[model samples]
Target: MKLFHYIVTNRLCHILSTIVIAILISTTCHAAKTKYIWQSSDQFVALEQQDSPSTNTVAPNDHPATVTSETISAMLSSLEIRATDSDKPEPLFTAVAVQSIAPQILQGLRQASPTEDVTFAVIGLHNTSYGFVKSHKVTTGRVYYQAGRLNILIGQAQKEVNDRDDRRLAPFTPGSRHKTSEGDWQLLPQPGQKGFSLQRKDWAAFSTEWQPPAAVQSVSPQQSIPAGLIAPARQPSPADRLIVLKELKEKGLISEEEYRSKRQEILNLL
Candidate 1:
């Protein structure tokens, strides 16, 4: 009977050991699974990857990997799409974060005394001629630099406009869309605002709230003309002089008749 009992106890221990080993094996396999963002092997594939992915039971030694420029651009494009899908009534811009900006552009912006983020702000704009409002809702624009054209974002306009007012001035609650400011501009929130504005003059605010004409830099190289010395002489062209007179008149430097007589006198030279 003692021998029989010993054999049964040994069989029970073996069964328990096998069950524990199987559980550990299953856990190891589960840990080997990778996460979507962890899949850095390819950026485009990573983004366009299964919109819905199953969580793996295990983690790999090294998982979703490095961030490439392609990944950044692709990620930005997705935000743009979200902003587009949601429409608003005021001007909007999407802000993003990066380690550093390109040097040449940074030099120009630094001269403007603009915050570093403006460097990226300069890049995101498709049209250099118009204004962009950073740190706000998407672009279903209320007031666009270009008139008579409608703009929309992946979200609402009033909320964004209000948000611009708040960030440029105060803190706003996340879900509540409407808020007041000195002028009470409507500003909306975009998840995209995360890193776009770390470079602010104020640490308390971290960034100024939205203000119109976020940045406008007009640069023109000037040819120095010595004060006392006359410009070097060249054979004067009648048409060139006429062009100058016309330009001066348009610029209100001279009267229309003055411009006409100047043109006639030059024509007489011909």
Candidate 2:
């Protein structure tokens, strides 16, 4: 899995700047990082949710199938979506197709479960989109959806700035999983949406059915370690310690006095 360096998200009123003097980690220049995506058919139920069907249950956008949705239309079926902007009552989720992310998605989809309704959401400091050259040398950027079952390219209804990622996953720390108050990762408008605001009680309720971690194997009380094999309490084994002492002395890790002390301990064990 390849990792692309990503930047922090700056608010519009605020500028989310990268680390002091950063580099643009091109995805093609480097391979896409292995990212964990959380998906759910019921994500909308947790939204300010006004009854929305998932991409699988909804009609295909135009006609092509997808795993993720950038625009509302891409994620929803034929239902009338209220425009976040009343001036554009056309649809809330408009599909802004960035063809660059498509081929990779198609390729990943081939590797996922054929029957699963896969959705991928991430909140992290990673590039959500990348640039690619078209046949005619056209430069383009698109949202990259890489997950099991459906590696389809989708995006926010109208966002086209591929170099800039959705602020969605920006705040997530690298190499850690995030849990909402709901205890589920998928309860967002998109995956890892802004301002995780689930109530503490809701998080508790969600965790009620969450099973406790499987019990680690219990060691038998008879599995007592032999005291003779315990060696010295604070040191390594005599044979091993002797080896270390010799190496350290040879490698100049210890003075002669320290070497003598260790050497004597090794003999004392015998």
Candidate 3:
């Protein structure tokens, strides 16, 4: 009887071990199967409303202009790259963070400084595509630079008038889009602020509140340009244009056919 009992006990232990092993294997496989997605702070699509003129052309103070330009250039140069089995790595600039040090930097440069009460925020927008057969939410990953001011808003108007395809009113207008500022186009609001909430919300008042994240300062090459010099308005070079096109494609601003056609055109120029 003792021998029989011992054998039964040993069998039970084996079965238990097997079950434990199977569970661990299943858990491991489940974990391995999990997919990762990059999420941004906000998402938006282009609106159908007739385009309106932009009103955000406050001549930036020298200091504010310098700091913002440097911040933008550094942000672009730091495009994330992926390693592959080749000499060249592919760039993955899907996520971007723009922090504002305007108030801090400006105080030292100019006598009359921007009010200390003004707060700057970096907003991220995501463009969603429905599927191959149809389009879902049109685009994502739109960045808006908002400055909380006492009286006038600085970045509001220009961001509103631009279309999803980055089309803008002719140059020389009050809010006419400039080429050098093309890099900044995405950082502005989509046309009509469609599907976007521009007003400030009181987060403390609600149980669930959305807050803009801290600017992503991760990548490298912290470079800056002199403030006084106006970035040349010449048409963007091929490489620069490619970057813009890639962004537009990723954002779903341009259809696949449009992207392909424009890409071929740019390549032909090269």
Model 1 poorest ten-residue lDDT run:
39-48
**For residues 76-192, could you state the per-residue lDDT of candidate 1 as single tens digits?**
332222123335333223232111122322232223211111112111222221334323222221100011111111112223333233221222211111222222223333344
- lDDT (0 to 1) per candidate: 0.30, 0.28, 0.33
Q: lDDT (0-100) at residue 5 of candidate 1?
A: 100
Q: Candidate 3, clashing residue pairs?
A: 97-216, 125-141, 125-142, 126-140, 126-141, 127-139, 127-140, 130-136, 143-187
Q: How would you encode candidate 2's per-residue C-alpha lDDT over 41-67 as one tens digit per residue?
A: 101110011112353232222112343
Q: In candidate 1, residue 215 scores what lDDT?
A: 28
Q: Which TM-score value belongs to model 2?
A: 0.21
Query: What would the per-residue lDDT of candidate 3 be over residues 197-217, giving only the tens digit for each residue?
Result: 322211001011222223444
Q: Could you tell which candidate, 1 or 2, scores higher by lDDT?
A: 1
What's the CA error at residue 130 for candidate 2, in Å? 29
User: What's the number of clashes in each of the models?
Assistant: 41, 13, 9
Give the top-scoring candidate (lDDT).
3
User: How much is the lDDT of residue 200 in candidate 2?
Assistant: 22
Q: Rank the candidates by TM-score, best first.
A: 3, 2, 1
